[model samples]
Structure formats: structure tokens, C-alpha cells
Target: MSEPWTLHPDRALPADPATRDLAREIYAATKDLPLVSMHGHVPVEWFAQDTSFGDPAQLFVVPDHYLTRMLVSQGETLPRLGVGSTADEAVETDPREIWRRFCAGWKHFRGTPTRYWLEHELVEIFGVTQRPSAETADAIYDQVAARIAEPDFRPRALLDRFRIEVIATTDPAWATLDDHAKLAADGYGERVLPTFRPDPLLHPDRPTWREDLERLAAASGVDVSSYDGYLEALRTQRERFVAAGARATDHGHLFADTTPLDDAEARRVFDAALAGTVTAAEAQAFSGHMLFQMAAMSAEDGLVMQLHPGVLRDHASAPFAAFGPDKGYDIPVVTEFTRSLRPVLDAFGHHPRFRMIAFTVDEDVYSRELAPLAGVYPALRLGAPWWFLDAPDAMRRFREAATETAGFSNMSGFVDDTRAFCSIPARHDLARRVDAGYLARLVAEHRLDLDEALDTAVDLAYRLPLAAYERR
Candidate 1:
């Protein structure tokens, strides 16, 4: 017989009875707070169209790299799991077969955050009552498919049901943002916003750099043939994003280096890159210089800057070649933020208009580097545990690591940073539980009073993200 499917009310609370009681109270105080998703990857078109999601496999499996990457690690191929190679390629056409594959590999998610989020989505969101396994897969899939077919299960309906006050979707710098404009015209602009991501145009070493530059130029109506023009084009695109209700700019670079280059040196590197004669070293230097320029732009424009560095994307070339990027090959690299960000910090760390939130896959930096920097810099706030470190234990560890130095106010509250729309509530709920448990322990230790802890819980769940992202 399959095990029963259930989510314990105190699933992530502390194990001890005294602390568990305290945690429950803390969680109850903030559990119903509206979600402020400042950073995420959900497509804006879904909200604009308000369409019903397809089958269970497409909704829960294919779009989520967190699930696909783990399944692939256990000898499952992407094509078999309904993931295509290119943008237009169709690999697995049968939803039932895809669901079967996922069910067969269900045991692999044990002790993983993906498992927790999946269970919450299945039980709480879709009202699934049966555990997922090879035997129960078809029945559960049918149940979820039936729910998805309902009008109440559509994107906008679910967003409203989830009580999401605001969500910001990651958008390419050169994107037309027509969907965003439509939503704004429809009067949902404040509810859903765009975040400008210039990763493609920042690194000239990437193969698609020239193409991305041309796209950016077209979007901005500026000629990006020279370095100055490139900067101007980027500025214009940011303004466009701001006009479309954007409040933040997202950067995902491989390193945290923020060294600035002189104008002549920057132009020289840009010219070499355009001429296809730029070396790897030159490319990295130029990228670092661009980080400084982005900070300068933020200082001028007041758009919050979000730096998510130290990820070596597409670690394996085979999967990247077979399937496009974000197939879950990104790996965390060692990062040094103290020195890497010094140049930019020196330039604009005290600027009243500039604000930056730094995210790191390198956990060592939380206490040693990030907390110290955020503690001192008025413009800097430490972003929550991101990507690989968003797990329950990792989040608790992050609090233990960073809180002593930076304190609660200096930290940006939990950011879902997910592409899975249905998983947003689950992710935020988990973060809240973890935080409540942490705060309960502090209260038990007499480090904080109960009233203060409650207030802090509310801030972490709702207020801080809005403030950090400047949503309000």
C-alpha cells in the first residue's frame, strides 16, 4: 500500500516541545501575510493571458529544473522527461509517459527541498490526496489534470488565491515587454512587474553577445556600435523597464568581481570584443567593469540592483548542446565579495539613491564577507539564501551565519526566485516556518522578547521584501 499523503502543520518547526510551541505561535502570526515576490523567473505572459496550465507533467516536471536535474542525475534523459533540445524541438509528446517517468523517480527526491515543495503543491494547491509513485501516478496525474482544466486553476485565479500582493518576473534587457504593457493597461501593473536582466549583453565573450547587442540596440533605438553607445543603449532599456513598472535590475555573473576600468581601457576592450580578438582575461575584466557601470547607473536611476554572482552556469557542455541553458547544470563556485566589491563600494556605497542586494551561492561569504559588508554599507543589503541554498536547513544556517553581524533589517527577506508558479506559496511558506523556528529559539534563549519576534516574523514574511525591492 502507498503511504498516505499529508502535510504536518508544524512540518518545519523545531523538534523540541517548548520551542515547537513558540514556533507555532510565531508561524500563525505571519502565515497569512501577503506574498511579496521581489525576484523570480515566472513568465509574465501567463498572467497576461490568464491561461489554464496544461497537464501535471508539464506544470510540475518539465518547467522545473530542480526536478529535472535530479531525475537526470539518476540516468534519466531530458528528452524522455518531455524536455526538448532546442526551443522548438518536441521530444516527449505524451504527458502520461512523462508523468510515469517522474513517478518512477519519485524516491530520488527524498530529503530534498524539491520533494517538500512538490508535496505542498500536490496536496495543498491541487488537493491531491494520494502519494506519488508508479502505482498511483496515473490516478494523481488525472486528478491534477482535472483541477487544472477548471477556470479556478488558471494563472490569474491562482495568483489571487495565493494572495500574492506583488511579483516581479525576470525579463531580458532587450525584451519588448508588450505583455507587461498589456497588463499595465489592464490595470495589473503594480501587481506584476518586470526585472531587467542584462546578463546576455554584459559578457562580450559569450557567442550570442553581438546578437544580444543588436537586439538591445533595436529595443532602445540606439546604435550600440561603440562602447559609449552600448552604455547609452543599456540606460535606455532600463528606463523602458522602469516605465513598465520595474523596480530592480538582476545580474547573474560568474564572478563577484566589480573592478572598474578607465573609459579608454573599457572602449579598447569593447572594440577588441567586437573585432572578435578579445581574450578570456579581457572579457572578464570588461565584465567586471560593466558591474561598476551598472552600479553607477543604479545610483543615477534609483533602480534597485540585485547581484547574484558566483554561479558557473552550464557546467556540462553536452546537456547545454543537447538542451538549451537552465537544464540545471549550473554549479556554485567559491566567491570573495569583500575584495571583489570594494571598487564599486568605494565608488557608490554611500550614495543615497543607490541600493544593492547581493546574493551568493557561496555560503562561506554570508558570515565572513556579505554580512560584514551589508552591516557597514548603507546602500547594501544581504539577499536571502539563493538557488542551491534555498533549502530549509540552508536557510536556517543562513540566519545563524548572517544575523549576528548584519541583523534582520540589513537582510532582504525571502525571495522565491522560482519559475514554478504553483510552488511560490510552498517556497514562501517553508521560509516562514524556518524563520519562525529560528526566532522561537532566540526567544527561548531570552535573546529576544516575544513581541519583537512576532514583529520580525511579520517583516520577514511581508514587509522587508517590499522595502528591499522598493516595491512600496
Candidate 2:
């Protein structure tokens, strides 16, 4: 009989006998490093409530788009997997049923990072001894459910147990941040910080732009009737986030363009958008201009700017309408940065206090655009493989493509960029192992000494994120 699934200690390392031995040492050195999840979408409400994760499906399947998207590709219905239910689609209410569906589709996640993270969570975190499948679904669910029911498995307790040194939660520009304030009062604010996300405020083409602008006014106590007032309102709200221990601002625009329009053009577009008469071209230009404006704000306030463009949110409309945003349909579009970001980089690339971390799902830009840019700029750093490129082979490919031009210092280490809270350590672990494997090749090739490789591994695993994010 075959044995139940288990995670190998040397998983994700190099394959060669000699290089694999070197990778094992490097991985061992950095495997237990404290995770600094500087960029993620984990909800702040988790810590504020300190509640137990409800069940196995709620904790693992329902909230993880990575899992849901894969299961969806395998012909499973979205609502049946416990996603949002509309009048047209009835969501499954039984957590056990959702678990069964996910287990049955487990084979679909192979060759995906989703599989690796889930396996780590099951074997290392939850102590599950059986492989997930139709036959073992109930047994594994029972194991995970009972484990989370423990007092130490509450959200706050998991933070300590996971050794997550710091985590940043993405919050909208208009959020009241009362939850973050509550976290501060409890002395957990600095450990769990907020990241300012102003995508709605910048994109005039969005249907909710006007409503979100009013929300920014309400939050900032500024009159956002004029373009100047709108900019001031954004700045004031960023101050609120900074006061709450924010160290970065996150932007996910569709395009990487950052050319700024003149004052008159800016006002014209703003006026058109306010009247709901802005054309798609004008809105695209204005969004790019707003990105430049954001860079200017970061330059002044010292908030580390994180820009990840080239994603078409909600690629499939039917599922999106039924389940809403983040339903696992955001697809990557080809993106360019060299010319698109010239305006922002030209203004602040050499600024002493200015910093920006550039991320992309478009891996083609790593060697062609991002690495070459970061190689020279004093203020820019290349972010790790993000979103679609966060898999093991893609990550290794990124190192091979970018490290030659940008080297290790010009990178921002790794950001999990996850919405699932339990996978924080697992994601970081996967990254560490991949980095170790890459660095082992260098040591074996005599490009770097073993001690030097170990130091770089620690930097990639721990130190670099702190510096890239301006974590003092």
C-alpha cells in the first residue's frame, strides 16, 4: 500500500546530488527566519476580533481564490464551493460539502504553488497525516477543525506561532481605520500595519469613482469638489494611515504609465470624471497621472510606494457578476515599464528619501524592463515574483532572469501578497527554499562562497524586506 502524502524536508531545493546538498544547507539556514509579510490582503478584522476560524472550508477553501480558481477550472461551480451566492446562484452552506469538493479536486492543484502552500499547511501546521481526496476529506477536515478550535489557534495566537514579525493589510483610501486604531490600542498596531490603497480614488473610469471620492472627503474632512482639494484629501488620508503605523502604499493599476498631465489637463479630466463624462482615453491618462502624483506624495512623506500593474480584474464576467470581485478571475496582461514609468522615475529615481518597489505579473518585464531600471536607480527596487508568477519554477526563472542585471541588492525580497492568513508562513517558506536553491547554484559554481550565500539567503528571507519597506 502507498503511504499518505507528506511534505519532504528538502522540497523545492535543487535536483542535482551536489547542488542539492548545498541547497539543503542554505535552506536549513533560512528556513526558520521570521516572516515579514510586508504586502498582503489579510483582513484586519481577524486580529481585531481574535476569533477562531470557523471550519476547515471557511479557513482554507472559501477565502482562498487560488484554490477556488483551480477548482473552478476543473468544472466545479463557484457557489457550490461556498463562494458568494446571488439570487441566481445558491451557495453551499455545508462546510463539509465544500471540503469534499476541494479534496476531490486536489489533483488539479499539482504543479501550482497553491498545492505547495496547502500541503505545508496540512502536514506542518495542522498535523494532518492523510492525503486529501474524496475518501479522506472528512477525516482531514475533522483534524483541521479540531485544531483550530483550540484557544491557541485563534487569529492573534496564530501570529505568534507563525513567527510573522510584521504583516501589512491592504486598506482602501476611504476606510475609517477604526479597526486598525483598535489594534493599536491593544499594542498590536505596529506588528500588523495598514497599507494605503487608492486605486478607486485614482481611476476616473471606474463607476464608483465619484462615490469613492466622497468617501475620501468624509474620511479626510476635506472638500473634494476641486482637483486640488482632491489631491489634498488623498494626502490627508495617507497621513491618517501613516499615523496608524502604515509604511507603504499599494497600487494595482491596469497600466504602468505614469506621465503627468499639465494643470489645465488635470483639472479638465477631473471635472469630466466628476460629471461622469470622462472618456476612456482621458480616464486612462488621468489614472497614469495620478500614479505620478502618488509617487510625489511618497517622495515627501517617505511612504514606500509599491506599484504592481498589468492585471485585468474580473476576466470572466458571468462568474464575477455572481460572486463579485476576487473570485479568482483576475488575469495578467502584458505590461511595460521603461517608458511608462519614466515620468515618475525621472522625478524621484535619485531622491534621497524616495523609495518604490515595482511588482508585476508580467514576467517578461523582469529582464527587459524592471531589472535594468532597478540596476541604476537609487530609489527603486524590483519586487519578487508576484501573483501568477509566484510558483516555484516561475520564481526560479525570475532569479535566473533578473539577478544577473539587478543582482540581489536591487530586489525587495518576497511579499506573499496573499488574502489567506494561514498560508503566510507557508508562502514565506516556499520563497526561502527557492532562494536557497538559486543561491546554492552560485556557491556550487564558485560565484559566491558558502558563507556569503548564506548571508544573501538571510537577506532575501528576512533583512531585505525590512529595508525595502522602510521598516525602522
Candidate 3:
């Protein structure tokens, strides 16, 4: 056994004395609040099955894209990292060896947020004092493996231990949600909910667009060969998700472009897409049109809409082909929200019932575009910094940039959009500490009252994310 390791106070703040002291004070106030994860990609199977996790590597390394992507970047095959479609693949099987490999390469993540979260997981969750290294790999692996075998280390058990009040997992519109159904039946209803992400069904540029459309039609009991039928089918899926306790719908698009095409043009584009002949421009236009229609439907159904746009997904073709989407090859690109969102903003920006949370990979937009748009539009609110931007520096930068244009009220609070269940607490803890650091600076400068800063800290930690995603 090793001596206990603990996170240093002011772990994520600048080294400057004033900011570091303020950050420490702020962190102390909000570190224990209940976590409310508004959006994430964790499969619901773990909670549904309620099975004991197998090993340290299988539990942490295999399911984390961040870990796998880092290893792959250094010419390490993902299969050797225990990432494969099925368990039958021949690769390194010993959990200790895998941990050793990861530990050997741990220096690759030294300055990254992954290092921060992994350290938290190691010290706080696994009770390891020494940093992960080749010398400590076997002992660390054994300890984590032993801890996971405990009855209280299961997914639901960890949820309670982590103090997660609500965790929303993203699900595609075409999904049957049988896993969520099983969870609800097993009585984890209040803790886990689904967010409907309708991208695959809307992106006509995808290779299996028509096939996915067919699947949607079959699943929703509608004939989706035509544009109107497709819209109806989407509405049916939304209704199913609503019945399953979904309060929001998420859209991941290359751009925030929105178009309100007339019925004739929409039908024409749908026919072309169905025939595998829609050009890139036409497909984009069609997707934009669907976005508007979806917003109108959201107005009627009361599901909050989330637009996470301007991500250049699958940028590295070879890795994407071999490993599939979300292999950490996604890159941020400049986005023009002001022009791209004109159509949707014109149609629904003033509607009180229509709520759209805007997220971006483009940090420049937080201050210049998204904040201003969200500030003025009654329907719009700024989502937390996402993906690559979820780090402590990005969170603080987002607050500094956007709070001037769109007050804290116009921005939804932090969300741990993570798949690693154990990392949930660590991610939220980082966000809270960073947020508190931000507020503490405001206090130190006398820009905000101590009482107000404290209240805002609590809201950022708990209330805001729940209110943003949970239907009003």
C-alpha cells in the first residue's frame, strides 16, 4: 500500500499569488456540490447491466477515446490499448502490462487536462499516492482492480458515491433505447436520462444516409421516402424519446447554417438525397432546412435544442477509416454563427418556447459571435465550452470572453461530457474549481460582491446545467 495522494489546492490556477489565493478560496466553496452532467457519450449499458467491471485497463483505458487517441498518436496501435470491436482480438491481455504501457507514456499528457483528471482518478478514486509510472504500474493496477471488484464500485453505486444528481447520455434518434428502458425498469429513472441527437438521420452526406433513413422509417412506423414523411418520422422518434424522459435534442453539424426552404425545394432535395445524388451544397442546404423544421417542432414539443457546430470531424482519413468516428481526429474550425444561423434566428430566435443552446469548437465565437447572439435572442443560450475546450484554461477563458457580452444568466453552466463514469466527479470538480477561480477573481477585483460571487458559484456548479437541459 502507498501513502494517500491528494489534489493540491489551486491545482488549476495561474501561479500568480493573488489569483492562486482567490482560486483556492473559490474552490473550497463549490467542490462538494452535486454533479449535473447535461450531455455525454457514455453507453447506458453499464447502468442497465449492473455488472462488475473486469479490470483496470478494460474499465478505464478501453472505453476512453482520449486515452486510445493519445496512444495511437505515438504509433501505438489502438488494439494494443485494448480497443476493439469485440473481445476476441489478439492483443495484450494482462491488465498490468497495459497499465505499464500507459504509465510509460504518461509523460505525453503532462500538461494536458487528461493528466489532471487522471491524477484525480488515481489519488481520489484508486487511492494511489505515487504518480503512474513504469515502476508503480503493477501495484497501481492491482489496487484499482481490487477496488473495482468491490460491490460499491459498480456504475450506479459510483453514481451515488460521486454525488451525480443527473447525468444525460446522448442517444441517436434511430436508437431503440432498450438499454435506457432496462435502466428505467431497474429503477434508475431519476438519475439517468437520454438526449436525442439527430445528426446521423439528418446528414445526407454520410455513406449510409439512405440506409439510416430506412432504419428511421422502420423504427418510427412512417414512410420516409419523401420529405414530409421524414419529418413525421423524426417527430415520432422525438416523441418516443420524450416518453423515455429525454428533455433535450442535440445536433452536431459542420456549421450552424440554417435554411428555411419552401416545401417544394425541401422535397426535391430529399428525393435527390434518397437517390444518392445530392451535391455537398444541396446536402448542407437540406440539413439546414431540417434544422429549422426541427426547431419549429421543438417549439411545439418543448424539447430544448442544442447545436454543437463547426467541428471538422474525422479530419484524418486513414485513422478514421481504421478506427471510426470520435477517434480524437476531430479538429476545430472557424465558424460564422452570425451568418450561418440567420435563417433559424429569424424564424425562432424570439420564440420563448423555443430554446436553443449553442456550443462551438471555435473559441473565437464565444466572445465575438455566440455570446452576442445568445444575449439578444430570447431562445438562445450559450452552452459550456466543449470537447477540446473543456479543459480548465478553456473554461476560464470562456467565462472571461463571454460573460461581458452574454451575462452569466445567458450562459448554461458546466457539463462533464465524459464517457468515463469514474471521471465524472473529476471532470466536474475541475469545472467547479475553475469556475470558482473565475468568480474569486471577480471578488478580488471588487467587480462582484462576495455574496453574489458565492451564489453564482453554486449556480454554475449545480443549477444552471440542470435548468438548461431539463425542460422548463
- Write model 1 residue lDDT over 3-56, tens digit each, in one string: 678888889899999999999999999899999999999999999998888888
Model 2 TM-score (2 dp): 0.98
lDDT of 3 at 414: 86
Report lDDT (Cα) of residue 274, candidate 3: 83
lDDT of each residue in 364-444, candidate 2, tens digit only = 889999999999998999999988899999999999999999999999999999989989899999999999999999999
What TM-scores do the predictions have? 0.98, 0.98, 0.95
C-alpha lDDT values of all predictions = 0.92, 0.92, 0.84
For model 1, name the residue pairs that clash.
Answer: none
Worst 10 residues of 1 by lDDT: 84-93
Count of steric clashes across candidates, in order: 0, 0, 0
Residue runs of model 2 more than 4 Å from their true location after superposition: 1-4
Q: What number of backbone clashes does candidate 1 have, counting pairs of residues 3 or more apart or in separate chains? A: 0
How many residue pairs of model 2 clash at the backbone?
0
Give the CA lDDT, 0 to 100, for residue 275 in model 3: 86
Alpha-carbon lDDT of model 3: 0.84
